[model samples]
Target chain A: MISQFIFIIILGAAVYLFGKNVAKVRRNILLGKDTDRSDNPAERWKLMAKVALGQSKMVKRPTAAVLHLFVYVGFVIINLEVLEIMIDGIFGSHRVFAGPLGGLYGLLIGSFEVLAFLVLASCVIFLVRRNVVKLKRFTGTEMTAWPKSDANYILITEILLMAAFLTMNAADYKLQALHVGHYVTAGSFPVSALIAPLLPAGAGALEAIERGCWWFHIIGILAFLNYLPYSKHFHILLAFPNVYYSNLNAKGKFSNMASVTNEVKAMLDPSFVPETTEVSRFGVKDVTDLTWKNLMEAYTCTECGRCTSVCPANITGKLLSPRKIMMDTRDRLVELGNNIDKHGKDHTDDKSLLDNYITREELWACTTCNACVEACPVNINPLEIITEMRRYVVMEESQAPASLNNMFGNMENNGAPWKYSQADRFNWAEKG
Target chain B: MELNIPTMAQMVAEGKTPEILFWVGCAGSFDERAQKITRDICKILQHVGISYAVLGTEESCTGDPAKRAGNEFLFQMQAMANIELLNAYEVKKIVTGCPHCFNTIANEYPGLGGTYEVIHHTQLIQGLINDGKLKAEGGESFKGRRITFHDPCYLGRGNGVYEAPRAALEVLDTELVEMKRCKTNGLCCGAGGAQMFKEPEKGNKDINDERMVDVIEAKADVIASGCPFCMTMLSDGVKHLNKEQDIKVLDIAEITVRANGL
Candidate 1:
């Protein structure tokens, strides 16, 4: 009965995870219609190699970088233990590996235990750095929407993960005391020895307790896995690709003006251009207009606020905050996603998501200086989105700063931005 | 007939295989003091055995100001016409006295299929000095004169030609004091990007005014620059700040011409 329950639970969890992940991938593909320069396969691969495997972005801050590296590696390697836990739950044996393999498994578990302890220690330091140390650096100065819930979630998740680890050790001790079937518990023997003395003196009750603890450990891991897609921890999956595919050039150099022109023309006249109108306008006005990569960026934002700390515009008291823009776009996107899921695409009467969210003043205040992009640890190019929106406002709606409009008109008439006669163009020269 | 003010075609028809094309930009051709310096550069080049062709009244604005103003179409048309005119003369290279025109032709013209080797007159003068083609008399060294170089936005940040202008100043052996923000991180002269053509938005301090104080702080005898736009703005800033008598604005070309005793 226990084996059947474990098997059904594992199967259900796997299916749910796979289905949700697929839906996420599909939604992203559908949303990321505005990403420029997807033609170069070699460039994409090179970026992936450097960003994903190398952990390049995290290294911007040394202390945080070191802490993240261990957590990242620990999170990845410990999946094997998760798998082992699920298998043991079905098989009625605490140890899955036998003989030489069993010895290796014990070693791996010991190593994982040490890494877990390190990750916990680093996470504590990170918390202190963010909270007690009161370092302005850790504050997400850019994103005002960074919920207080995020810190709580991180703290609780760490504690829960540690709980899972301890419970597994307790189960291991009970199994050893019961004289379980032979499986080399080599490296784990020390853990079992320490745990054995702590187990209840009544052997009969210990077996039942061991089974219950095993179930708790498995459920704890599964619950954490399911919670990942909904939390800021979603960055663990998204940041890898986000960093890899990030623009390799300087901030302002990411997209050319010529490319933007081509896109605008294509949107206006599809028959002449033959390129399908994937999304209207240049900038991301709503969540659906954002490219999947941008949506991924929204999900991946750890709310670390590193981008805001270095923004020249923010420091100078400009209304633009790169982090806030990203979070606002993301919040609207999530709301839009929920609406779409609930009501389908036919629900067009719903109010425009962008109007209620980002203000016109916030849009105009940005100087397109790539400082925010440069400071971002996760490779979110907020300036690109900001500029694209500006382009749309200027070209499509013909709405821009009144002074800029007059300057553009003057440029059209006199070939100079000043409304002087063409004859007087060289007046400055004659005076010299 | 369309008024042909000694176009490159006419110059070529006269059997002139000019050693250089002196691109007197729109500002230099019209502004009085700027025109004098342009004429000075022409006379200097002529004396140095370098025959140069002038575009005269045929020259027009480089359309940089238009492009920066967001009139992309007008800028494109201007670029296309300039390219055709330059290519008509089989112009292999150009030397401009204007930094804006120099930068536009050197950096932006290639995008419009007009690729020619372009150099600022200051850079050419520096090269000439280096090659022993131009010699300067070291009579009384201007060493004690604290001179600061104001980096033009177009020539410095837009094109990364900071060192060449500084190099020209270094050859003169003056006490070159630098502002806190110089070279790539240099602040603008409140000109360039067509900002000169428009009234500046109300702000606590003018960018150029803020820049002039750096020169004042250095107690510099001169505020030198390679770009004519910077020269004009910095000169105006010095005067506006009532330091015109104490601090003078001189183009690197003007300074170079003086150093050569021309």
Candidate 2:
């Protein structure tokens, strides 16, 4: 009864902390302007299934894909065991489902053990890939200090969590062999059974080890849950929604600003005189200027650098890394969120996301090729964000490159992008 | 291959409603090299007996360059003017040799009440071949010649069209090779997003040069492309390598015209 009470108190506290962090991130995303992505429910659901659940894009890199698949599937499916543990902790029950589930419970437990081992192996391999193999995409300028440590931290945490679960199972198996109190002959620990022989061979030693492992594993999971909102690993939760809300329009199609369209319509029509209003900023200048979906994209970035890796601009040694674009947005958003929290709604900041975070050089380097958008396993559109910043630079500040300004002038005066008059448009066909 | 292409105003004066309006884009109109593609498309249209008329001087820029350059205001102004003109003409079933113009007119223009049945010239040629309107038997020069098609981002990944251009290429009796990255995973030719108007930032190598590496690896005698912008970039790439004389960069329409002797 005392243990159950202690379990309830700890679980409640973990839940509270996890909920607070998740809520804060949600509020941060809502700081941006609204944009409708609510249309096309069926297509959105299909995308979620294929991209997130199916891991369709992850398999582009075969070795990493397979390794990631094991870890991913294990992380998701092994949680069923966590569910059982939670119930057991609350109710003070020993192997609660084993009595009714019979051999099926054994089969499930056996599968969980195999997956746990696979997850552990994959985590170690992933650690090696990041720290030892030193993949070019992983060890970039943006991936220094905290970003690098954060990735290693997540992998290490998962490794320890899986280790704890297996250790607890191994000790429990030994306790069951000794017919100790509350130690039922329940889960068939196929993988953990090997460790049973290695454990110290006394009842008191076994009980202490089992309880320590059990408590540590649960607490570790709780810590991971709270850490997600602060880490790029937040993609674990956001990937589904991000993929679902992905832009369903053709990749080449740029979204037209309705305000600009309306203004243009008014200009074209003599009857509808546009109301004279004060100068409003055009395009995205700050976090709040971006659409809600764009903000959500920043939060959904996994920092895996797949988009950066496949980027033609980056591959050709350009300054623009799509991953860096997302990271900058997310970091700026966090700053904005913290500022709003500290200073209230009326407070202003000297810095904006454009020059303060992403530079003009990086913005112009993008080709808008949709490669970054396509390469993202979770369907984040970095091109959209880059384009928005470029729009701000050109439309708001009129700071386009001299060549682009020349083209813009040509477009404004003549009907075409060149200096040729409209009368000369047909001159090509008149040629010999 | 020379043919007299009539204007929309001339077609109206003749009291005829053509089946399609040929949207000869800015590059197709002015660029000396892209003009060849325009002429070849005209020849193919004339040979296939598909009644098509151009807007001629009435046609303006589709504002793709402006939109991509982040000048939304300029793009909107240009788009509205072209839309108003097209609406006045009641034009439907538009076709363009440039994928940039096709992408903008088909996808972007609809939101501004400028929707029309816009199709790329490659798609039109593919349709014509499929409809038995045009025949592309192995010509003397192009028979089993090594031809590699560079997938334009706007056509392939942008619009989810990977097959139509290839199908058009398939009709020609040439060895159709593919680059290392093709279709959905194809690389850009360093021209999209208004990059053509400005010099590229300092980098190890130009994107066109990198793409040229793929073309060279594919060992293609002729690099076939669907977009005129891509044609220009790839042609420059070929010229940079001084392989221009050896490897010809031809539009799919140009290839078809040569293949059919239209």
Candidate 3:
């Protein structure tokens, strides 16, 4: 009765904290401007299935894909055992499914043990890949202390959770073998059986170790659930919705702002009266100017750096790194969200996502080749943000680079991007 | 090599409607390097007995560069002017040798109320080849020559047209070599998104030089492309590598004209 009371209190606290943080994040994302992407539910569902569920794009890099698949699949499948553990914790029961599930429970436990081992191995490899091998993409300028440490912490946490799971099962198996206390003997422990012998024999020692491991595992999972909202691991939840609401238009087609289009149309008309001569900002100057989809994209970044790895500008040693763009947007959103929390809803900041985080050199270096957009496994479009910011720099500030200014002038005057006039458009035909 | 290409106004005056409007893009109209491609396309149209008319002085830029460079106001002004001319002329079907123009007219223009059946010149040539209107047997046949295609980003990935240019080239008796990165995975030749209008930022290397390494690694005798901007960039790359004498870069229209002996 005491153990069950302690379990209920801990579980309640964990659920409350996790729910509060998740709700906070949802509210933060809603701070962005509205963009209605409700069209075409069929295509959105298909994209979610292919990208999130099938993991089709992840397989582009086969080695990382397979390793990640082990952890991902292990995390998913082992969580079933977590569900059982939670129930057992609440009721102060050991192997509650053992009698009812019988052979199926044994099969499930055996598979969980194998998967736990695989998850441990994959986590170790992932750690080595990030720290020891120091892959160029992982160690680039963007992988600063927080992101690097965050990755290491997640891996270490996963390793510990899997280790605690196996240790708990090993002690439980030994206790069942000795027919000690209230421990039952029904489920199998294939991998942990190897561990069972290493543990000291006796009922009291086994029960204490088993309960300690059990508490550690459950507490670790709850802590991980809460940590996700604040870490890049947030992608584990956001990737599904991100891919589902991905931009389905052809990659070449950029979305036009309807307001700007209407303004341009008014200018083009022969007889048009301006209703409001009041100035309208041409493009995004702040987070509120960006669409909700853009903000959601900011939150969904995995920081895998596949985008920066394949970025032509980054590879060619330019200032542009698509991964950095997403990271900056996320950081700015966090800053704004925190500001709102501290100073109430009407809070405003002098620092915007533009000059405070991303710079002109970075934005200008992008060729808009869509390489980064294509390379992103989760459909995070840094290009969209880049283009929007570029529009702000150009239209709002009128601060394009000198060469681009020349091109813009040519287009304005000659109706082309070159110095030549429209009257000369057919000059080559005369030569023919 | 003189080709008599009629203007749309001339055709209209004669009370005749050409099957298609030949949208000679700015590069094809003004750039010396792209002029040869323009003539080749005109020669092919004549060879196949397809009546085509140019807008002549009435033609203007499609504002692709302006839109890309974040000058939407200027782009719209240019686009609206051209749309007015196109709508007045009643140009139903249009074909252009430039991918920038093709992409803008086919995709972007529809949003601004300027919609037409915009097709790339390679697609038009492939259709003519399929219709058996143009013969591939004659002068300067590419028989057994190693030819690799450099996909223009706007044409290939931008518009999802990886096959039409290749299909047009398949008629030649040459070995069609492919770069390591082709089709959807093809790299940019350093000249998209208004980069053509300005100098490249300080970098370890130019994007064209990097793409040139792939082209040279393929070891093809000739490099074929469909977009004029790509032609300019790839030609500059070939010159930079000093392979100008060893390798040749020709537009696909030029290839068709040479193969059909037009």
Best by lDDT: 2
For each candidate, what TM-score against the reference? Answer: 0.70, 0.97, 0.96
Query: Please, what are the lDDT tens digits per residue for candidate 2 over residues B117-195?
Result: 9899989988988899877864445875799889888998899888888888887666889998888789999999999
- The per-model lDDT (C-alpha) reads 0.65, 0.89, 0.87
lDDT of 3 at A348: 92
Q: RMSD to the native, candidate 2?
A: 1.6
CA lDDT for candidate 1: 0.65
Model 3 docking category = medium
Superposed model 3: Cα runs more than 4 Å off: A273-280
Q: Tell how far residue A262 is off in model 1, in angstroms.
A: 7.8
Candidate 3 reaches a DockQ of 0.67
- The candidate 1 chain B region of ten consecutive residues with least summed lDDT is B1-10
Chain A TM-score of each candidate structure, as shown: 0.82, 0.96, 0.97
Q: Give the worst 10-residue stretch by lDDT in candidate 2 chain A.
A: A272-281
Worst 10 residues of 1 chain A by lDDT: A250-259
Candidate 1, residues A1-432, lDDT tens digits: the string is: 668575667868766995796486457446655555465668767766666666675676788889988877877887777777766667665566534475676678777777776677787887777668867755544423345457656766775675557555665556665666442343464444555677775655666665666666667666666766666777777776777666654332323245444443454457646344343454445666656666777777777776666543444354556777777766776666666678896454454434576665556555443446656767787766565555555655676667777766765566545455666654432332
Q: How many clashing pairs per prediction, in order?
A: 21, 0, 0
Candidate 2 DockQ vs. native: 0.82
DockQ scores of all models, one per candidate? 0.16, 0.82, 0.67
CAPRI grade of model 2: high
